[model samples]
Target: MDERKLPSPCVVVLVGPGAAGKSTWAGERFAGELVVSSDRLRALVGAGEDDLAASADAFDLLEAVVRQRIGRRLTTVIDTLGLDRERRLRWLALAREHGMPCVAVAFDTPAAECRRRNRERVKRIPADALAAQLTTWNRVKKELPGEGFDEVLQAATEVRVVPEAFVQADAAVRREDAAPRGLRFGLQVSSYTHKGGRKTTGEWIRQVGARAEAAGFDAIYVMDHFRQIPQVGRAWEDFLESWTTLAYLAACTERVRLGTLVTGITYRNVAHLGKIVATLDVLSGGRAVCGVGLGWFEAEHKAYGWEFPSTAERYALLEDALQVLPVLWGAGNKGFSGKVLEVPDTTCYPRPLQDNVPLLVGGSGPRTLRLAARYADAANVFGDVTRVREKAEYLKAQPRQIELTHLSTTLIGRDQREVDALVNQLRPRNQDPARYAATANAGTITDQVGRFRALAEAGAAEVMFSLPNLDDDLSPLDTAGEVISAFR
Candidate 1:
């Protein structure tokens, strides 16, 4: 679903038995032009789809189309049994020759299930042929990983092993009869593009903030990162400093709150973070939510010359930050001593405009959740509705109230057609569109309404979402506002 994974513009050979749901899988994820089906070709050229004399012509046409598509570096889904090792190797070689990544999607649908469906099909293959395909599938499933394909994924699971990628729990889609109430929404701007030229970037950022506020967003946040994070974008892309951008946004928009999605506790002096948050609060009329987390990106820390501490040490630093931020923003100077911080004097000039600035912890670990429950006002966690349900159960059990918030990267399209277009535009070439759509939580406006309603029912009091297309423009914010309005 993210860039660190193998996605698209590659040759995908479907490796499965008949009635394994191969074509059905491909049709849901791929466009007609992207899938080259041998059976379909046979049906077109022969007495019928099951015609034996047209087999040679069907395969020949399949190879010709695969060659042309690979030569052009376009994504192609080969809809065949894919049991022929020699044919699979040929396709792999063609992809490699064209500098494209070749993937083999082996369906894991059980043999019994295949047979059940095959029995139901009007044009079912002969039982012997089906049996042979199943035998071959059993052999090929074990061989796929060692084969030369870039990745071999089980079509049943929309996920493959990837670092830092989140696979959402399968939550049944159901809309609440009544709209949700008291659920807040915010927009987190993660990717910064240079598409509009360097000079136009500031204006674009302002528009994003203004549009988000107009769209009924309760707050607007930007990722506190020195470089573009790999999960969202590549390095060397445009990344504005977090607090300055928040200051600019605070000036551009009124009423909407401002904050960083999270600031790395290791990035700056703990006391300095308090000063920064305090200043933003005053300038933004008390609309500041300071999100802090144990910093983990060592590459950026090394690049910026900030010492990236061990996990324990980072948590220690975060604990001290959470304890001291309040004291620093209070009336009198105070001394604080903790695991990693020893502030002799917390003399902060120009105290925060709010009596108590809302501190939101941005991590989902048990220790982090406990820390939030003990000290922070709110906790922003990630994962699907199931994980949210688990975390919500834990946090709610605490003696004190801890607000629950969620960060979901949602793809909101007006309808299924627009959703499909964005899927084609954003999903990696090899990724199945249906899986990517589910992974991204991509859907129409009504679907998003139901999606957020599910999140709310799972105990998310507020949901901060980012649009896939918001990296360049504010087009979707207005539509997103409609979802926000439903909750209000």
Candidate 2:
């Protein structure tokens, strides 16, 4: 089989019962290819032809060769008898971990035919060994696809092996595991403020955080901004910095993870920002996600005297910042040189508790989506199912693991009157009153739950409900709890 004909980034596993001629077929068909054969490795290592110990060592060597070759984008053909589902699954796991496609080629020839072929060979296997191999083969054949083989090729007999298309048969095994399963929920505390009689936001923050955790929310996110919007209240209103609040929340909460709904890359140096998040993660015991976005709100930027550039310039800076952040988090005293910002050997202490901190980017724009596709661990969008589905489809086109998260305002009420009143209070804030009215009034609890369900089914990995107010009465908090409970 010509390696060029197979998938570019893929690992093909040839599986079958004893005497199925997998080795012979691969050897003859895959000449000049990087073939990983346990038999060949065992012989080279001076492991006796029939020594089990030597075979194990040989398998390890074969795996190492396959890994090295695959890393270089070379097509590799495994010529061993992969008759155990677990053994085959290990290969699939490797493929997934390396972000490579994988396939399985199964040879399902009859027991009598396999025995005949084995008898013809000078170095024939014992009859008992062949029978055991056949039994294991039958079991794995039924289980391979479920175990994560993206493609499966069936060769019932030698006649079925067309070298030209046999390789393509294995290409069918490139299936990915179904998108992560479960009801995932996130919380966005946007209304929290310390203005107009309110002094500090910490009290409300702790309250909201506690409520969200008690309600079984998956994550609690705060808005990243230095000042309150004038439309909401006074311009000089007291506001808490997002990351500092999150650090406080990290120490206060246990079950719920903490992060910013959207952080501005322009506010702080990227490397410093990464180290701060890493420290928060360590403080939180690994319950931290870094949600970021290209900074907007020119007024706030002006007030702080932060470098607020044109939209394109900010995005360019954001892109550079995102790239530098990971390096600072992972590498000690490492400096980054980019078009926007450059640091000379600056080290940030205490890396994040998580192995790879979740990097979330929030924006519905195409540029943001592309950035998410290229760099983010997840993307956050605020829209209905239709909008979300469209964005998800766009993100899916990229060859990366980028989860989508949808954000929406949620108001739950037991009675229609209460629901109507809440909707009226929310109506003034909506840019589109009609749309808000329709969504709020058009659904029952079940109907709303179904809407969220549709969002999830349409590829939303998680949904976050932005609360109407961060009040101590906790009315919205209670309502959100009921809605979340009903959904669960």
Candidate 3:
């Protein structure tokens, strides 16, 4: 049998009559860890593989293990006869539920040959029983093609398995599915730096993360800076390291993606940053988005004793960081020779759970936009609706159509008076709120929804709402949730 590789992070199911060498074929083609065999599981459960009474318990274990592996987006192979259409459908449904592409490897060995092999087993089945199973296999093989499998491969004699074919197919499928899915809402919790009325405690941050997820926000972003941005609050204020904050948030919430609004590339070494993002993705079940940009804050850079390079030099460094990131995420130990960064050999162990962690590029400058077009999966802009539309249009004009996301400071309240008060409080602190007016997508539910509709119409695929105050009561999230539900 020629060795073949199946796609990584896929669900591969083997179908054949009993004694058709499914286990042997799976062993040859897949890693032992990747193959979930019913017979092996049955043996482990104090029931011999041939114990018909143990079949029920054996299959239950198999399904549980399959679900666990698929949930992790790991490549898994099921070694089973798969002769039952009802059972096959259940597995197919599970695959679809996880957004995993299913591949069927149907064995076409002659029934007589299968029976011959069965006779040599420690517990042989009756000839009549073997014949019935073979009859079922014959019919099942014909139906496997139409059973929602993304691809079907037939194994007649020597199983010819090519793993790269599966890899390519999986990549193609993800690329097709990666298109923007309507207008997503992300919550940018910026109140960590300052106290509106109450101190921002650890408990407060956790509550913010939990409430954001519960409110159905697609992602939660935190500013990546050593000190509070001057626009958010006084430059000298409480701040958390970007990756550490994301890691903490990753534990606090399960659904909403956690990442920096835009990680300043110079903050960490390119290799280390990639590892950090990959680790976060694994921890968050693939909910980490790598939002990176050229380091923009000169004050923080100087305060941290790091040199603040010129704009051209910073952009050059940003491009180098982008070049180094993908290789660290998935590429095995290999030399990465870039103009600004060089590595003799690099390997990021424990690859991210997501096949591709999305890269969001921030900023709207022409050079920044060009780098985004070249490397980013998404582009983020913060400004009025017209400015956002213009940046989105510029990105669209580029070769790649990156997902466009708009950032805004939200101040939603239950009523107009409450919202007006919050707006007034924010206006005193923020320097250019009136100038970048559309970036403040706030007010009552109706007002916020109206703004969301306008952003969506202007080609923004997502909007990140920055709440100014962090409260244990979660009134802001409750109000945001109401507006989010309207989009649904």
What TM-score, computed on C-alpha atoms, does each candidate reach?
0.70, 0.59, 0.60
lDDT of 3 by residue, 1-488 (tens): 43233433568888988888888888775557778998888887746777777778889999899888777766678998888888778878888888777878888888778978988987897788889989888788788888888877776433322222122322323332454236799998775643443355676778888888888899999888888887777775667777888898889998988888899988888888888999999999899999999988998899889988888888888998877788888858987887678866678888999888899989888888899889989888877667878987888898877888888777677754565456556665643332222235435555566566667767889999787645556777878998787676
Alpha carbon lDDT of each predicted model = 0.83, 0.72, 0.76
Error of 3 at 363 (Å): 0.3
Tens digit of per-residue lDDT, candidate 2, span 1-488: 22223334467788988788787777654433546887777887855555666876887788788777666655577878887566677777877878767778888888899999989988788889999998887787788777767767665322111112123322222111123236688887765552333554566677777878887788998889888765445677666788988988887788888888789878887777877888898899999899899888889999988778889888887788777777777756767788778878657667776878888998999999988889889999977666889999998989986899987766555544455455556666733332454443322243345456667767898888765544556766666676567445
lDDT by residue for model 1 (1-488), tens: 32113434567889999999999988876678889999899998898888978999999999999999888777788999999999999999999998877888889789899999999999888899999999988998898899878888778644221111211211212334443356889898888783786789988988888888889999998899999998887889888999999998989999988988899998888899999999999999899889988888999988888777899998998999999999999988879999989999999989999999999999999999999999999999999778999999999899988999999788888866788788778988897675577567776676677667777888999899878777565778988997777676
Best by TM-score: 1
Q: Candidate 1 regions off by >4 Å?
A: 1-30, 33-175
Worst lDDT run of 10 residues, candidate 2, spans 157-166
Ranking by TM-score: 1, 3, 2
Q: What's the lDDT for candidate 2?
A: 0.72
